[model samples]
Target chain A: MLAFLLDPAALSGPADGASDMHPTRQRLISVATRLFQQRGYHAIGLAEILALSETPKGSLYHHFPGGKPELAEACVTRIAESSLAAIDRLSGSGLDMIGFLRRLAEVTAAWLQRTDWLDGSLLAVIGQEQGGVNGPLSEAVRIAYQRIEMRLARWLMAEGVAVARARDMAATIIAAQEGALVLARSRHDAAPVTLVTDMLCTMVDRG
Target chain B: MLAFLLDPAALSGPADGASDMHPTRQRLISVATRLFQQRGYHAIGLAEILALSETPKGSLYHHFPGGKPELAEACVTRIAESSLAAIDRLSGSGLDMIGFLRRLAEVTAAWLQRTDWLDGSLLAVIGQEQGGVNGPLSEAVRIAYQRIEMRLARWLMAEGVAVARARDMAATIIAAQEGALVLARSRHDAAPVTLVTDMLCTMVDRG
Candidate 1:
């Protein structure tokens, strides 16, 4: 897995020790993110993360002090940011808005296809895994979903739609996509994902 | 854990069994459904189900020849049937169409609330649980979701809506409610479920 980081210091730098991205941190995040995304947060353990990441037990705490919960927070935040960035990139390509969404759907389909039809959202899997009774993980999920909705809402507003209507529609679209992903994962197929995107684009055109 | 199956003996009654439901069979389904809902499918074991339901070990195989997968299938089927029956009862009450949907939402909300703010859809939980590659559970999930969508579509069409449009809307509403349940479960709150229901009702009214 690539080194996914919020800061470049987590990359490679000299002068300050803080400027250097430790290998262990990168390894931990990459492995934990994948496992949690695949099997769910509650179903994964630190030992498995360590073994997959090829990192030592001693340095796990150096990166995440709060343990799995902290790791989960980091993963959720990272994925949320990455998703927003991907949406921004899709929108920036100057494609028509609906076409942009379709392209987004296709790219998502390709990614899931590569993962052998595994569900990729860690927060989503965790929410189901823990069943929302746990506080921190549940909060992570709420914020992550809200972030996606907010980003989509912003896009809708940019298209000169009504704010309230755009917000509701954005939430609906997000829910549809998430639900479609669940369907895709359950059936181990990407057709539902693409079909939903088509349906959403059709709805947008109808409006 | 109330009896999930309205009639478990139906499975055997087709052959050479009593016409009435068996006590151990009902107990097994009831406990297994609750456990599968509260904990996950794989996380709960046959021993745990037997212990909780107080059904003897021998009776489990007697009731479910295919073991956990068979038991899970039975639970999913029963929950789906019960939910459809409830919706039918509500819609058949001779209320206005919108009034019927509202009541349906209320009943759904009440059930969700009583479950301590947990997402109570056995089908949705099972779908997520069986999100594996090419498993029997995955196939069961697809059938369960399809069953839900078809039933909802039938209801909408019977209310004098266009067939294609009703099916589309049914798919959307089912996806939305399932998504909202994910939110509600993660937040451990009923507000999201109610919000989604209100949104659905609004959309149905406009349509």
Candidate 2:
């Protein structure tokens, strides 16, 4: 289910073996993303990230010279790219629009349950906490969310919805899912997310 | 728009003069609420709150003996009470369900614009950041959100919807609005929120 929101491949390591494959660097990025998603960006410090990643202090500066901000930016970029790819893959599948939305919701709910509600979409956390405070991080989050919205909009358009309508529907879907995830996590239950999924399906089917 | 999510009266001060009228304490609560809403719960420090509130250190400990956590709880409680009161006022105003939601969206959008998207729902910031991390704070946030949801459900029930269906729809409405607010704040525009509002009104009107 997390794959629907963030690609596991991106979290683990680089897709291409061309470079950027240092085990220490990959571990740092992976751990940082998890910590940021779980505990928020500001709450987690560089020492914690370093200690959790088990990477040396020297290696941290070597990989990310700009420190926490630089590392956060990298995590956001990777997650964004992976999420966009996942969207493309899902949209290209043989399922119709309604089917796609149902599948997406199921995966999301399952992911939330699996994580014990400790994590939600990275985009959501970033968008909520860091959106306006940090310039580069905020921009990265915006781009990530916009890319996902555009991907959803394209799917709606393919199903015969008008351009403007498709865009609006896409925004609604993303926003609703994000909000439901927070509710679900807060209550430690998946019912909120499931309810939202059903509503989205109904609305899209009617359209 | 903020009045739709959080009552400005709550943000500023008490509407009545019957009691609970400690100006220093009230000022502390108000400033803490705004800071927590704009930045986040963990991001804002007690010292900063003191500086912003312009209250003495001894006074902070005097009013909120439990320190930052106590102050945060007070803020959450006050905001929740004010928000519920605002909803009551809106629902009692004789507007249909659609009209109520449109007004809510408009007010929320305008608030976002007015604050340059730096501020969103206090419940949202608390629910997203402190939820699942701080036990007391999480519970406070949950109660705040649930109270709002129940108020919304009551409105739907008054419109002749069944109890169970009304409850689910209310949850959906809150979740969607919360999510759209994040998107709007992230993009530094209110278009996303406006789109969600229109869709919500359509759904409620049809039902």
Candidate 3:
């Protein structure tokens, strides 16, 4: 679900820390992703991101010539990649379908509580902020969500669910998770997500 | 769900044309609600709302002493009232649980297609944009959602579901519907919401 935005991968630079990549550029992405997740896309400014990242004011343009939108695009892509990686890791862990979902929900709920409910799935924020608008950022948001859905569908299919049913269930789970996160944030509590987790578990058990 | 933003009441002046209320104020609220639903709360400016509402540039502060935040408060309240009215109308129709949920989803899907997916629930947008922050606007957003949830729970209870389960189902339904709307808007199709409707119907039938 959109909970992938809360993954530590979203806040860290590339795993290898290749010498060719500038550390400042990675820092900027990390800061921007954090801010975007906590606040809506439009509520944040480039100046704040640069200051928080400790990058030189003029260097933002040097690294991202396209400015805010360009930086936003990079953050979206980073989040998507990190989220897909997390899903792959979970899927490979040998947990049953219900076990995997429960673990995912627990991680998400913990993150929400840790952050004081200030952060949620960046994909959800961006999707709502920029959905239906044709742009690189919007396209990035769409792709991120699709990747999560596909990964979930694969996990469901591996559990012996029919292809069509797996896909539908994956979509429903993703949608339900995203919605529950919103409710959790709004109510300043994680119980909504817990309820959703139970509901999804029941559905999986029924099948 | 957040689908109430698509209600015509959200875009029109108060019903029964009160003699004391200024039409310009009503127009401003209507325009602001529409823009806020389509775009994030922080992305839109007062100038744009006033221009679209056809209100005089100087009259904005006169109608809304608190400026954009105050205006946002009014829009939130208007949406909540309109949404409650919609729920009341649906409940009074005496449709069975599945029938009512399916009809609600169908109407929401039709609205998404009508606006070409440019609009969604104002409550969803505000809840994501301002939730977890302390302010009147954020509080208003919370109240709006709670009202919707309560109305839904009341319907479920009326259908013989236990109170605890009814509340949980209400929250799940609201969250799922909001999430499905985001998915549908992002994918530029109503199939996501249609899938959600089916999932919701099954859950309701089970109860």
The candidate maximizing DockQ is: 3
- Looking at candidate 3 chain A, the ten consecutive residues that score lowest on lDDT are A10-19
Candidate 1 residue-wise lDDT, A1-207, digit = tens: 001111222222231232255667766776777776766665577899988888877788878888888888877766666666656655677776688667767766776777676555565566666663656766777777778778877887787777986766666566556666666666566765665666567556654
What digit string (tens of lDDT, one per residue) describes model 2 on residues B1-207?
Answer: 122365345466443231566889988988888887777778888889889889989999998899988898888887777777777778789988888888888888878887778776677766666545758888988887788788878878988989998988888888888888888988898987888887777778777
Model 2 lDDT tens row, A137-175: 888888878887887788789889999989888988888
Q: Candidate 3 on A1-207: residue-level lDDT in tens?
A: 644535545457353233366888878888888888778799998789988988887899999999999988888887777766677777788999899878978888888887888887787888888857898998888887788888878878988988998888888888888888888898887888888878778778887
lDDT value, residue A125 of candidate 2: 71
For the predicted complex of model 3, DockQ is: 0.72
Candidate 1 chain B: 10-residue stretch with minimal lDDT: B1-10
lDDT of 2 at A122: 65
Per-candidate TM equals 0.75, 0.93, 0.94
Q: Indicate the DockQ of the complex predicted as candidate 1.
A: 0.34
Compute the TM-score of each model's chain A versus the native chain A and list the values: 0.85, 0.89, 0.92
Which pairs of residues have clashing backbones in candidate 2?
B1-B107, B1-B108
Query: Considering summed lDDT, which 10 consecutive residues are worst modelled in model 2 chain A?
Result: A1-10
Q: Rank order by lDDT, top first?
A: 3, 2, 1
Better of 1 and 2 by DockQ: 2
The model with the greatest TM-score is 3
